[model samples]
Target chain A: MSLGCELSDLQLDALRELMNIGFGQAAAALSEVIDLRVILTVPKILVLKPEEVPAFIDAEVEMPSSFSMVEQFFFGHFEGTSFLLLPEEEGRKLASLFGAEAAPLPPELETGSLERETVVEIGNIIIGACVGKIAEILKDQVAFQAPRFIEAPVDRSSLERRLAGAKDLALVFKTVFHFERQDVFGFLFLVASEGSLEWMRAAVDEYLGSLA
Target chain B: MGFKVLIVDDSMVARLAIKGIVKDSVDSLAEASSGEAALDLLAGGREPDLVFLDLTMPGMGGIEALKAIRSGHPSVKVAVVTADIQARTLAEVRACGAYEVIRKPADRAAVLALVSRARGEGAAP
Candidate 1:
């Protein structure tokens, strides 16, 4: 389906490579933190109008009906949010990696609690590392907001808060994350704010030039 | 006289990385987190032989900053560094008086080369 994106073919290709680099850096950082070989892969990347985002998410994301998620926003060079969504079982397993048991309630007990801290750490490293690496490569500076734990069946308000009143477009990247031989029911999403598409277009253009 | 250099970027990591890039040739090093800060330093009389200016910033982007600097401080050398490059935009930057456009992910050699070219051979620390 056409999303009305203005990126040229070359720009799109360059963006794919940049996304690979950005996520690859995140995976590497996560691996170091968890002391395991973590693999992060982006299966697809799409730029959609704000109105087109919901349907795209419904069809593409197809995330677990109910789940635990962690999300954080990164600002500066490119404004955007990164989300980590995990199914109940996968959420439990991931928390186990950081010493939290599967819970009947929300993923976190309370903000600032140890369990929540673990989730925050995961979100922080993944989001900060990815955006940080990207900013560094671009020779720009990007600041990250503190991460928060989210529960699925997300409220519309929470969804709208990401790019509230943003006037540009959004680039959505679907990331698949896992450990060696472990079927981790998890997904990673990088959502850029409005006006970011242009910034990204320019970045990809420059990135390609550097390669040339 | 050793070369005095100013690195402008919002990211501390980038400033440090750029500093390392030109460290061997630089006798004086300064950093600014934004274009406005860079200008403030310049206005405050911190004269540098060259400046590595990042394009994407919050308050005043590199383009505007470059324009102001070119008009006000014609003698200072500024290199535009950014991940965004297009023939049109690159031309615009050069037209605004950038010594050169250095694409991001810049290596040490490229940085040193730019510094040497800006400062002239045997002009560095």
Candidate 2:
């Protein structure tokens, strides 16, 4: 069964604009936390069946071998799943940037409290911004769970495993985030089941009409 | 007059970073690891002029704490100090009645400015 509804051209345009706003908000949060310029490429939104995700991941870019924090949040009429990928090389720089008192050892286990804090905060900010933009566009209120940071290296296979468990039919959207100073790169994902997608479209339409 | 501030975050390192910024302008502050402990401090009669809250936490996250704090002490002003910049999240925080929303890893100057703004200062930087 399909997990998400496909987006119409107009809905796609609307969602694209809204996603940009959300990304900008996430960038602002990153700037504050990283104490550096945080830039985000224009978000790339795609409506694809769940099966298409593996192809997209394998073809677009090689998944970086680094520790990442995967966060999940749900809001009024929509749900968002976000992944923050930090390059392992940047891990040392991040330790210094956040003034972590730890040996510049390997990131697999050498991370200290401060770096963990930084990671969690960064994850929260981006997720918050993206979700906030969506809510604003939909003109609805939704509660969010604080970001949960997992200190684990993400490989292509692992990501594929996660994607495989997604709802039957799905709407997959992706965005790229580029952090200055340490060359930290990350991506945000939005997955909606088919039923959820229909509800989301109607919710977004209502929001647009209210705005008009 | 300068006011006391309390910061609640799991990372002692984060607490220190925020302390560095807050100390530049504010004279008093305290730190807590979780929302429940922060509330415990307040219940123990420790009152602060401001609270810098981290949204994502292990237990009793920022949202829950915000509701608890507001209902218990409507007078305390809260500035959500987090790195999450999602608009939907901010709208919810605002709806929760936060005094202001400030992003995490804030600089010394920004910290002073945000607190001042929340306290109804001239304007935010």
Docking tier of model 2: it is incorrect
**Chain B TM-score, all predictions listed:** 0.93, 0.89
Cα error, residue A137 of model 2, in Å, equals 2.3
Supply the DockQ value of model 2.
0.04
Give candidate 2 misplaced runs (Cα > 4 Å).
A1-5, A63-67, A86-96, A100-114, A168-171, A180-182, A208-212, B1-125
lDDT of 1 by residue, B36-77 (tens): 999999999987889898775557888889998888788999
**lDDT per residue as tens, model 2, A100-206:** 33346566654566567667776677677777767765766667777776666766666667767665544445665555555555556666644556678898666
lDDT of 2 at A108: 62
Isolated chain A: TM-score per model?
A: 0.76, 0.76
lDDT of 1 at A34: 60
